[model samples]
Target: MAITIALAGNPNSGKSTLFNSLTGSNQYVGNWPGVTVEQKTGKYKKDKEVHFTDLPGIYSLSPYTLEEVVSRDYLVNERPDVIIDVVDATNIERNLFLATQLLELGIPVVIALNMMDVVRKNNDFIDIKKLEKDLGCKIVEISALKNENIDKLIETAKSVAGQKKMTYQEFEEDVEKYIKEIEEFSVIKDNPAKRWLAVKLFEQDEKIMKEFPLYGKETRRLEEIIEEAEEKYDDDGEGIITDGRYNFVSNVTKDTVKKGRKGMTTSDKIDRIVTNRFLSIPIFVGVITLVYIIAINFVGGPVTDWVNDVFFTEIIGENFRGFLENAGTSEFLTSLLVDGIIAGVGAVLGFLPVIAVLFLFIAILEDIGYMSRIAFILDRVFRKFGLSGKSFIPILMGTGCSVPAIMGTRTIESDNDRRMTIMTASFMPCGAKLDVIAMFAAFLGGSWWYAPIWYFGGIMAVVVSGIILKKTKYFSGDPAPFVMELPEYHMPSARNIFKATWFRCKAFIVKAGTVILLATVAVFLLKSISLDGHFVDFNADPEDSILAGFGKIIAPIFAPLGFGDWMASVATILGLVAKEIVVGTYGVLAGIGEVGAEDSSMVALVASKFSVASAFAFVFFNQLTVPCFAATGAIKEEMGSNKWFGLAIGYQLLFSYTVAFMIYQFGRVIEGGSFNLMTGLAVVVLFIYGYLLFRKDRSKLENKNFSNKENDEVVKYESN
Candidate 1:
């Protein structure tokens, strides 16, 4: 039989490091299943036959959070042969709580005391024998990062998998009585040491109770015990169970562990400074500014430009155009390769360097555990606007792709918060948007700051919009309470960091190749086809051409926003396929042949018609609009109904239009003159939005039945 071993611990417990060390496979390292939360797993490299399941990192088995529930279900249902519970040796007291519950599952377990180096460095000591005696499990010391004693850990786990199962730690008199009573009805009744199941039954885990039915008297008996304990504990039965587990761990630690008599250490001292009440925010801003400067201005900008111009433009451009010229390729085929595919998707691919750098930094922050602090620091301020600090993660991820960013909203517990988060997450500039922003920056703004400015603008958009929406009837709610564990920081592995970079970069390429390919082909088809003796797109006036004809029909609609040019209209229409395609569409319409790095021919054409303000407005509109088709699908799946999906899309479009109108009108007004009477109508719309934004309460939209129920509850409770 294969020796099955499960690696388990709290988030950032070096579980991933240990798994990678043992498995040598980078199979799993995504933000989350449907959220920005990280997920990881791998199999042992040394012993492929020895199955290793890396369970999600969680604090405990209580179903208080989604991750905890998912983890608990896997452990209970899957029932691995042996569990190697990795404990952060430095934070043993807290880490042991999970281990204590794992012991109760009645599976053979070997405790891997991780971070022992840190423990020894801190002048702390844990009597391994004493700990083993107290917890009734084998304990092995190992440093997951340095790969020390890792082999010893695997050997011990293999040995234990072949060994007989161990019994759970005995509970207190009252807890033990209920344990016995519930065990009588449990499917694992033949095995009498299932202490945690009994406690879960007493705490009224519906899933557990359903699995093990009992007589009326027995059922009532369990309920009576749970109710009486709840009253005595002054908390819910679940809370009581949690308290019991922690208390048990505390007792075990008191005898075996000792801390050196010392003042605040280096880590604590640094934490005080970094996490300071007043200094943290400003410092964080400065840090972010510095990061952007390094990423966009210094590193990513030059490298991306090189990739765009040299690799994409010179190399790919020359070869593709040469092939077309040599083969006597048809104007349609030439345009498809040179304009549609190369220009559209290639434009987006140009910014891969910039995205890689940004994602690398994000991965580092996450691995080192600083990202959680970001949430904690922002929680209080964001709460006033009906969003939790947790909303920041999705917004941050949106800088890479809105598809995952929209999905990240699932982590938000409140349906209202989740919906609002989904609506706004994509407002932040993603990798696809970065290409457009980079294009404008290089071609229009003639400054490096422009790229970073777009990112900054996207972030500010979400925040300001969040604040406005919070006061509206549609978005009224209190932010969820913020509670999270701060894991001990560690130096991130190069392997893991690079793996993350590849993961995000791969997503970008996939979009460029697949979705953008289809969209470009569609654009080619639409722009080609017959009319007169001419290849209409190549020879005809842009206005009379197929793309131009469609744009002309919609051109008047966007005239108010200052981009009245038909090409701008066409680009916006193409944006429905993908946001990045707008830049590519510009290349095609400008009659630029395989647009290269040195080529500003198409950009000049766009500039002749559009002012800087109008260009910014155009970018802004696309940035905040209903995201790419993939994100829309994610919204539909996550919302789980078309009505809610429509609401999400409608709200996004409405918000995007409102902001674009404001920027165009307000900026134009300050610049003075050439304003039309329709500007007055836009001004009126702006006023209504202002009322929605600044109003003390959301009264106008509160009557809608689909308004967030959680937010309604919060509004009602707050009023009381």
Candidate 2:
């Protein structure tokens, strides 16, 4: 028989590291059953028969969130042969709460005490043998990161899987006499771990309490026992069970665990500097700036330029066009292949290195545990703006892709909070938006501030949106308190960072090569084809072509935002496939395709065509749009309706356009520059919308017969 082993543990107990080590390249990540929460499962490296299911890192089997529910459901329905409960050796007292709960499930469990190296370094000691005796399970020490003693852990897991069933008895007192009575009832006599089941029932765990049907007549007796226990404890079932588990964990820890009198370890000392109360913000800014400079300027620029100019612009583009011309290939087909597909999609794909580097840094921060500390440090600041501190992770990850960042909103528990997070998550420039930013940075403006400015624009949008939305009646709740387990700081594995970077970069390539490529070819066909034999050069003048004509109609609409150029206008039309392509489209249509060199040459080409103010406005519009296909799909999935998704997109477009229009019009005046008539009108219209957004729309009242304040508030809230 194939043995199924479930690895269960608290978050940051080195569970993921252990899973990565045991599975190596054998693991697959996907959804668990019907839930949106991601599930990771893999076969043991050498032991194919010993399949491992990596359960979500959770505190207990409580059904409060999708993760906990999925984990609890899997354990009850699948009933793995053995569970390797990974625990942090340094934080055994807190970690054992989950361990103790897992034991009650009546499955054979082996304690994989991870991070033993950290424990030893901290001068803390754990009596492994004593812990085994206390929990009635095998205890094995392993450093999942270092790959130490992992083989022994697997061996012990195999042994436990083959052995007869062993169940853990509760170590804490039974405050409820009825809980004990329920365990003793005749209906529960056959249960292997009646005491554990009884505790869960008393704790009123919906999963367990609802299972009383299996007990039949004894179910009534169980309920009576639970009532008596509830009265005696003077607390609900969940609280009672929670307190009991904590009490038991505390006793076990007191007896077997000891902390050295040592002041601070090397990591703690480093953390003080990195996560310092006052200096942390400056340090974070400095670190992020350094990351962007290295990635965009040093690494991404050279690599991306090579991919764009060398591979596409020169080699493939010129060679292919020349070959086709020599062979007397049709003009339409040549344009479609060279400019439409290659220049359009290839331009987007060229920025993969920049996005990959950004994602790599994010993964490093998360894996090393600094991400959580950043959250804790920023919680107070973020809360002041009516956004949760947890929102920082999604926004930070948004630097890579907004799809996952929006999906990360599922981690937020409050309904209003989740909605606000989803709305602002895409405000951060995602990998897709990087194409536009890089394009503008290279072509329109050449300054180190270009990249950082886009980043600050994204962040400012979030903060400003939060403040504006909070003042409204619909989103007027205080920010939810942030709660999360702080994982021990450790050296991040290069392998993990590389894997994460590759994953995001690969997604970008697939999207550009497939979706963006098809869209660009379509645009090319529309622009190049004509019934007459007149050879119209679409590149010289885009206005006379189909794409240009289409953009011309919309150009007047966006004239107020300062970018009425057909190239900029048409690029926005193609932005629906992905945002970054807008910049690449601009680069091609702006007649910068002939630039030979990488960084400086490309910058020179862009600067000659557009001003800095217009460039900033262009990037702003792209930043505030309803993201790409992937992110839109994610929002729909997370919100569970098209209505919410539509609202999210509509709000973003309105907000983005208003901001861009303001900056372009008002900013020009501040710079002592003359403004266009349409731009001034656009600004005036936005002012009205801004006023209506924050205040009552009294115009609707004249037509309506009557309205309730509650109904009006609801309508206003949903509109926002």
Candidate 3:
């Protein structure tokens, strides 16, 4: 018979590392059915029949968060043969909190004490035998990172499979009386988890209460018991149980564990500076600026130039064109191969070096645990805008890709916060948009500061949008409390960093080959066919092309933002398909026979069509607009309401248009251009925007007044 083991733990407990060690390269990743939370399953390298499910890292089985609910549901319903609860040895007290809950599940479990090396380095000692006895489970010490005792841990878990275990800890007398009463109530008598269910009932778990039917008398009795207990303890039943569990864990640890000399550790010492109240934001900004400088200018720029100029332009384009001529290949076919496919896809692929470098740095930051600290440091600022620090996580992920970033909002518990996050997350420029930003930066004389301007611009857009959205009725409540465990800082694993970087780069490469290839082909075809409805030669003027006709129709809409030419309008429209296509579209529209390093001809062409002011406006529009169609689909799925999805897309379009419009018209005035109707419109937009931004939220005022009135009434009643 095949044995199934489920891995569960708190976040940053090294559970993922342990899973990677046991499973090696044999793993399948997907979402759990009907939910966006990721579910990973893999078979043991040594025995394929023995499978493992890596549950989302969660602190408890409470249904407070989506992750907790998914983990709890799987453990309760799927009932895997064995659960290997990976525990961080350095933080045994907090790690065992989840272990205590798992014990009540009636499923066999083994505690894998991970990071034992770190524990021993600190000179702390844990009595494994006593801990095992106290928790009523098998315990194995292992360094998941070093691959030590992994085999033993798996063997121990397999041995405990399918066996029932009971928890050694018990609740206080008041809580225990009702738990026993609930067990004998007979409604859930056949349930093997009667004791666990009874405790959940005492805690008044709404989900659990709705699951089972209770007699009216049993309900009243339970309510009365809970109220009396709450009155006696001056707290809710949930808090009482929580305090009791911690008390039990404290007793168990005091008896069995010995602490080393207490002092600030290395991680603490670093956090003191990196997470300082005044210096954190400036430090974060400096780090980000340095990353972009290295990726865009210093390292990735040279590599990208070579790939574009030598590899594609010289070798591929030149050699292919020469061969086609010698073989007398048809003119139309040559144009399609060189101008359509090569120019378009090559434009995107040229940025592969930049994307790789960026992903590598981001992966390193994440692996070294600095990303979580960024979230922690930004929580205060985020809460002021009515978003939890958790929202910043998706925004950070958005810097890589918006699809996963929007989906990452599933971790947020509040519906309002999740939706708001989904709406604003895409405002951050994604990896795909990097090429567009780079192209515009090159157009603006290749200054290094161009990249940071757009990068920070996207961030400011998100912040401003958050403030505006939170004041509205749809997203007016206070943000949920921010609580996240900061993992210990350690040396980044090169293997993991390379793997993460490779996956991100691979995804970009795949899109270039698939989605981008098809889109570019379509663009070439549209631009090649004449408006009079006949195929045309490459030498023909682009104004006669069908694409020009369509672009002309949309060009007037963008005239206010400058770059009203049909080609620029068409490229902006195509960007909605994929942001990189904006650059590819320009390459195709410019009709450059061979693209070179920096594609000076294409950049020169764009520069002629757009002044500095207009170019920056164009960049702002593309950067702030709704992300690609794939990301839109993700937003739709996450929002789960077409109405809300439409609202999100509409808001993004309106905001991008206003920002771009202001940049162009105001910019023209500054550059000695005439003030006209568009300038007046821009002034009006600025005024309205200022009013919305500075206006006090009427809802907050009303709430404050109502609160003061209630306080006054209370004081008057007390005086009486």
| Residue range 365-475, candidate 1, lDDT tens digits | 777767777767777566666668878877777877888888777667776777777878889887777667666765564454564676678877888778776775566
- Runs of candidate 3 exceeding 4 Å displacement: 20-36, 172-178, 216-236, 592-599, 709-720
Best by TM-score: 3
* lDDT for each residue of candidate 2 in 1-720, tens digit (9 for 90 to 100): 688899999877888889988988898887777766778889888878778899987888888777799888888778888889999888788889888878877788899999898888877888888888988899999999889999999888888785666756453465645566677766465676576777776666677766654467676766776676678778777777787778888888899988874687776888789878788888877777776776676666678778778877788778888998899998767776777677776677777777777778778887787877777777757776567887776776687888878877776767777787888898888878877776665564346666676776788788778767766655666677778876767788887788887888888888887777777666666566433434467565545666667777888867777787766787787787678667556544533335554443445545664566677787888888778878888888887778777888888888888888877787667667876785678678777757745663233342343556667988999999
Superior by TM-score: candidate 2 or candidate 3? 3
Clash pairs detected, candidate 2 = 203-237, 443-606
- TM-score rank, highest first? 3, 2, 1
Encode model 3's per-residue lDDT on 316-410: one tens digit a residue.
87788889988999988888888888878887887888888888999999999999999898896667656689888888899889999998898
Per-residue error (Å), model 3, residue 626? 1.4
The residue ranges of model 1 lying beyond 4 angstroms of the native Cα positions read 16-54, 120-123, 143-152, 162-164, 173-188, 191-193, 202-213, 216-243, 299-305, 319-336, 446-449, 467-475, 521-534, 537-541, 591-599, 698-720
Report each candidate's C-alpha RMSD, comma-separated, in the order given: 5.1, 6.1, 2.5
**lDDT winner:** 3
Candidate 2 Cα outliers beyond 4 Å, as residue runs = 24-35, 45-49, 162-164, 172-178, 191-193, 213-241, 299-307, 319-336, 471-474, 531-535, 538-540, 587-595, 598-609, 675-720
C-alpha lDDT of residue 24 in model 2: 83
Question: Can you give the lDDT of residue 706 in candidate 3?
Answer: 99
